[model samples]
Target: MFKIKKQISKLYMASILGNLSLTGAWVAILAARGYSLVEIGIAETVFHIFSLTFEIPSGVFADVFGRKQMLVVSSIMRVIGSICMICSKNLTMVCAAIACFAVSYNFSSGSGDALAYDSLKLVGEEARYERYAANQLILYRLCNGISTLCAGFALFVGYKIAYASDVLVTCIQIGVLLSLREIRLDHTGTDRKQEVLQSVWKELRVCFVESLRFLKKAKRAVFLMICNSFVGAVDIVLLFFLQAKLPQTGMPDSALGSSLFIMEMGGILGAKLILWCKNLRYRWVFAVTSVLVLCGVLIEHTGIAVLMTLGGFVAACSDDALQVRTDAILQEMFPSEQRATLISMESFTFSVIMIALSPLAGIVFSVW
Candidate 1:
């Protein structure tokens, strides 16, 4: 048997490197290229549309091919996307870059946790998946927080320079992925061979059928999944547009990365706080944190940059808490067999909502 903890540690490192993409300045980069708010929205909408379309298919591919392989594919896509963003000078190229990012994200989403949980199960540490998951989330926010801070500093140099840094980090992440050994757990002797023989169309149908059956019994999880989608979509719009919105509140452009970095720092602390107080009920914590997030967003709408910055911090903290809680609950609700497929379904819902709402948000900003 392979070392489960060792694999988890490797995955954690990869997650950190993968997210350190100077993300705080993505919208700013496009804006710097002269893309209007509406055009930026259109690009995101295209991303969501392509993402929703490919999300499930990619998840199915992960299940059949192997999660480690899918992650490697994701890293490659991210590298290509980063290159596109670095070289982009117009709307078409930026949109193409966003599409690559969308595809890359879908490939990584369900597979990482599925791979981690399966590894734990293989080593008889399956029961500790919740704790393992919590650690992963903590690392994710912590890395993102650090990257955002650095990204702000990099922004002083140039937006392209920041994106170039992101590309280099992503390339290193691929090396991390290369070190992960793929674990194929097949009880039945012929499962792998059978999968190879099955047509792609058949695999798609099987994944869909199995997922629907599980969703039928897991109503609460289903509801949470849908709600998470809406919340996530709104959060994405707010996150991307936040830097742009700050100028109206008398905030200077140079401080945008710092503000975003601070907000991400708050999320890291919130995640750590959840780990510190593990006795808290997930349901109650999720409810309370979500409400706080809503309040923060509403306050942000008031056009006061300082208040908006504080609101962003509050929103980031609460949102991170909510995500940790939701991930735990969903882990409890679904068995390992269908975990990745179910998670992909949830992401598909999120993309659909973003596709519908992103354009409207763009229009409102454009008109303003």
Candidate 2:
């Protein structure tokens, strides 16, 4: 039990370290580099395209081999991505870098949560996974917020320096990841012998088939994933565009970091706030958050700097609240053996939505 608690604590530390990147405001950096909205949209689409392709396969690898292994791969990909971005001098190079980032994201997305939840499950503390999930979200939001607060420094120092700093942080994160203990689900009797006899391809095939079978029967899980992902995609698009849009509202470059930081605090708040909504039904939670997100969109379209920032904040807040709740519900529904793959499917859903939304949102924001 003590070791399990320590492991969970380490996961929290890893989350903080992983998210603390000097180049967190990549959209703003690209805009400052003079990329047009259409070009930036293309870059984002490139990312989701690779993400869509790799999400499930990466998850299958985690389930078949080990979650810890996939996370290490994620860190290495991040380092490579940062280096590529540092060397990038054209949109094509930027797209290549973004594809590396997408691969990094794919490897990490479901692996961490699977590792954490299974670790807790070993100790019969699975009920606490929701709290852990919320805390992880808080750490992610706060760390990313701090990184965004460094936007001015990142901008002043330039992309090479900013990306180099990210490489350094990722290296440290890799060291942290190396120290994590891998959790394996227990298989007994005939199942144990079957596991020993199964080839890697067989294991992967089983995990994939099981995940698909589970999803087919678990319609509620699929619905929850789609709804949560849609709201998240919308909020993310608004926040990403705000990095470029805020400046055009006459806000000085000096305040850009602070504005973006303030907007991220909404996510932190939402993560915390969802814990208080334990009594609310999932339907009510989804409905309310969806409406709030749309309200944020309406608010952002006003084109006033203050209102737009508020819009980003509201959207982020609502998005995180729904995300935490949905993750908790889905984690409970998933079987341990197929956990990571199923979660990756949820991410696959998000990537699809992001691929569809990002380009259109970019053009609309660019025109407006």
> How accurate locally, in lDDT, is each candidate?
0.76, 0.90
Candidate 1 TM-score versus the reference? 0.90
Report the C-alpha lDDT of model 2 over 1-368, residue by residue, as the tens digit. Answer: 23887898878888888899889889989999999888888899999999999999999999887899999999999999999999999999999999999999999999999999988887778899999998988898888888888888888999999999888988888988989988877532011112563478887998899899999999999999999999999999888888888888888767888889888999989999999989999999899999999998889889898888888888889999999999999998998888899999999999999999999998998998
Assess the local accuracy of residue 232 in candidate 1 as a C-alpha lDDT between 0 and 100: 62
* Worst ten in a row by lDDT for model 1: 186-195
Q: Give, for candidate 2, the lowest lDDT window spanning 10 residues.
A: 186-195
Q: By TM-score, how accurate is candidate 2?
A: 0.97
Error (Å) of candidate 1 at residue 127 is 3.0
Clashes of each: 0, 0
